[model samples]
Target: MMTEQRVELAVTKSELGARLQTSESQVAELKRENEAQAVDLSAMEDRSNSTELQLQEHKTVMEELKSTVEGLKGHIAERPKVAFSAALTDAGSVGPFNTDITLIYTKVITNIGNHYSPATGIFTAPMRGVYYFTFICHNYGANIRFGSLLYKNGERIVSMTDWQTSTDHDDNGSNAAVLQLEVGIRSTCVSHLTARSMMTVIITAPSAASCSSPCEQKTLQHLQRLPALPHVSRRPCSTFSGFLLFPM
Candidate 1:
């Protein structure tokens, strides 16, 4: 009986040792897995920080873009609307005298912004915008060349010429233009004329006064519609007019 017991005890001790070895192997594997997980967690944290930085940069750029757009909106809103036009009021005429002179429109048919002065024969811009101008001219068939020009800021933009080609007929012509004008820019109609007696023209406005060139003279810009006419003058013949299309 004592021998049998010793053999059983030895067997039991052997089994216990095998179990401890298996447990140690499993512990070692668990330790290695834990270390790898720690490494992965550190890398993930770095990536998370980088992603956060990118988000912050994007947010800053968006903010700047928003500010620029707002500034543009404000600028557009601040721009003003402007328009104006004028024409003849009565019958009139200028020179048969041989002299180049600017036509001053003393009578105003319409001055929307009061920017055009019949006295100066010029339209002064109140705001930056695109403008349209028109002029009509006529002459007494007194063997004279009837001519007119559109002037912008003292520069010639266009003109109309009507020569009494037929002694039996009165001469007439018209011209137009579209101009981009800024504040302080002035526009007017200049009359180019040849010798004759009285000339009469009509429209929303006048015929023209002869103008001298380089086209820059300030006062000699436009013409009067109604001539300070002679008794039985051709009633009304031409017009000088303009209007704003939109703000530039």
Candidate 2:
């Protein structure tokens, strides 16, 4: 009876030891799972922080771009629109004057800023800016030559001369210049006349009294000969055009 009791006690002790080993193994496995979960959570937090930083950076860039665009729009809106185009006459001939004469482009086609005056044959700059000017001279029939001089504040800037040849009856000459002008500076086109006197001196407004000494009576007589051209044709015989390229 004693031996049987001893064997049973031994079996009970072995079972308890195995149960302890199993419990320890489960505890180690749980610890490893908890460590892995903690690592995953840390990685997720890092990614979220990185995404938030990138979003902030993109938002800041967008704001700066928007501000720049708005500023450019405002600048464009404030810039003044300055441009003008005019024609010398619809009538056939203007020259054969005794002396040089300022050619008045009386027929205004487009005068956006109204800086060019038809009354005086002059363009007055409204502001300090870089300006572009162009002129066209046309002559047809006979042994006629057309010459024009562009002047800025009484100083010559450019000149154009066209002559009708035996083969070519019609002739056209053009000149263009980019000029830096000051506020209130005057620009004019003057016709250089020869002995024949067929081209310029064709002033009707403010009279011929404003002309040089030799031109008054001759201009008046010519005015009497030629009638006023109220209606002009589609194509212009001569043209003077200018525009403000940019403000200084």
Top candidate (lDDT) = 2
The backbone clash count of each candidate, in order, is: 21, 11
Residue 220 deviation, candidate 1, in Å?
16
Give a tens-digit lDDT track for model 2, residues 139-159: 554345445555544445566
- Each prediction's RMSD to truth: 9.4, 7.1
Distance (Å) between predicted and true CA of 160, model 2? 2.4
For each candidate, give its TM-score against the true structure.
0.49, 0.68
Give the deviation of candidate 1 from the true structure as CA RMSD.
9.4
Q: Predict model 2's lDDT versus the native.
A: 0.62
| Candidate 1 lDDT by residue in tens digits, 1-248 | 99999999989899988999999999999999999999999999999999999999999999999999999899867755454444433544344233444556655667766877878676666777777777655544433444555554344556555444434345556677777766676665544433332222211122221121111111111233222221113334555667778886
lDDT of each: 0.54, 0.62
Poorest stretch of ten by lDDT in candidate 2: 207-216
Q: Where does model 2 exceed 4 Å of error? A: 1-30, 89-96, 196-233
Best by TM-score: 2
